[model samples]
Target chain A: MDALTDAELTILGLLVEHPRHGYELEHVIEERGVRNWTALGFSSIYYVLDKLAKRGLIEAIGPRTSAKSRVPFAATEAGREQCAAATREALAEPSPVRARVLVAMANSAALPDDEVAAGLAERRAALRG
Target chain B: MDALTDAELTILGLLVEHPRHGYELEHVIEERGVRNWTALGFSSIYYVLDKLAKRGLIEAIGPRTSAKSRVPFAATEAGREQCAAATREALAEPSPVRARVLVAMANSAALPDDEVAAGLAERRAALRG
Candidate 1:
């Protein structure tokens, strides 16, 4: 099987912390500022949950009592193992150059000087706050 | 529209470096050790290319001569702007917390001590070479 995408790992980590339904997971992601660049959808969350479950890494528990029907999920032994393995790999090496920012950095010189400067300025402002 | 996924950016960056056909692009990705954990398929590349074209970030040129028919791609002005924006954002910040290693570090204690140690040791070995 393919290694879990960063998005999948993020969902797994959140689930490991606590069993949450799709909406709750989505809420936590946004609240934590994890969706700045990639806006993870509820569908993607459920998709990862299903994939994790299929891999024996996670299992669905009883549904949560909420305004909408929600299925909570819990990590299984395999899920914990996968999460651990993923963590180790992620830390041990330079992360996969899959990050858009890193890819962009590789060719930043191709961009206009003014645009690059403005973008950096905006980023600094965002980070400073 | 939502920010392009990292995969989309990677595809764009690759095209910016040189206009390549789908197979050629895929070959470059694998040759570059960019597909260690994530196996990027030909379909995904084409998908991203289409999306980029829709956003005016990329333009598809005439097909290339090869064993199988292939559509070559080139970066448009908007694509350059997007790449520049992405680069600036990536360098100016601490980077997204989306890296699985960071997330795993956040909860590394949950993993078996021996497993963690072994993983780190393996990582150190990999880095030393």
Candidate 2:
């Protein structure tokens, strides 16, 4: 099987934590600040869940009546294996220093001097914030 | 303009270092270990280049003759600005710990005890390697 995407791994991890319906999963992701890495829209979550389920890595436990009736998902044996493989790969790889900054710095000649300084300043502030 | 994708930014950075044809860009990418984070196939680079050119962030400087003549690229004023913005955003965000491992750990009950231990052992070895 193809390696899971970062989003897929994240969703699997959350499911492993406990069975959760789609909406609840979204809440946990937001609460945990996963959005800081890549924005996790509702559509993306459902998409990953569907893909995981198809792969036999995750299964729907049952529809539980919450404030609204919702279907919660739990990880499967295959899913556990996939997750373990993904985690090992993620932790093993050196964290990517995203190319965006490097490209900007390399091409600073393209920007007005003031704009370049301002951009850097803004970046520093954002990093601090 | 929307910020450049990671691939686009990598391409722009490479161009900034020195003008190069698409093929050369691909070569540098392979040599530089950038693919560890995400794969950069030939088509992906070309696609990103086209997108970057349309956004006025990158431009085709001129076609040069190698074994075969090819179009070399360069970063433009708008492109530099976009790159900077993307870089800042990337640097600012905390690197995501991709969710695969956590999910596996959480759902270890699904796996045979030996498999779970084996998985962990494999992860530890990969980390070391």
The candidate that wins on DockQ is: 1
Tens digits of per-residue lDDT for model 1, A1-129: 777766677778777777887778888877876764333665667777778878888787874454332777888877877877787776666554335445555556666788667766766787788
lDDT of 2 by residue, B6-120 (tens): 5667777676566777788888778866665553566667877787778777778784453322688777766556665665555444334333344445445545577667767
CA lDDT, candidate 2, residue B101:
49
Q: What lDDT tens digits, residue by residue, belong to model 1 across residues B6-80? A: 677777778877787778888888897665433355567776777888998888787445333277888887787
DockQ (CA atoms), all models: 0.36, 0.18
Native-to-model Cα distance after best TM-score fit, residue B95 in candidate 2, in Å:
8.4
Give candidate 2 regions above 4 Å deviation.
A36-42, A59-71, A88-114, A125-129, B1-25, B36-129
Clashing pairs in 1: A57-A79
Q: Candidate 1 chain A: worst 10 consecutive residues by lDDT?
A: A95-104
Per-model RMSD to reference: 5.0, 6.6
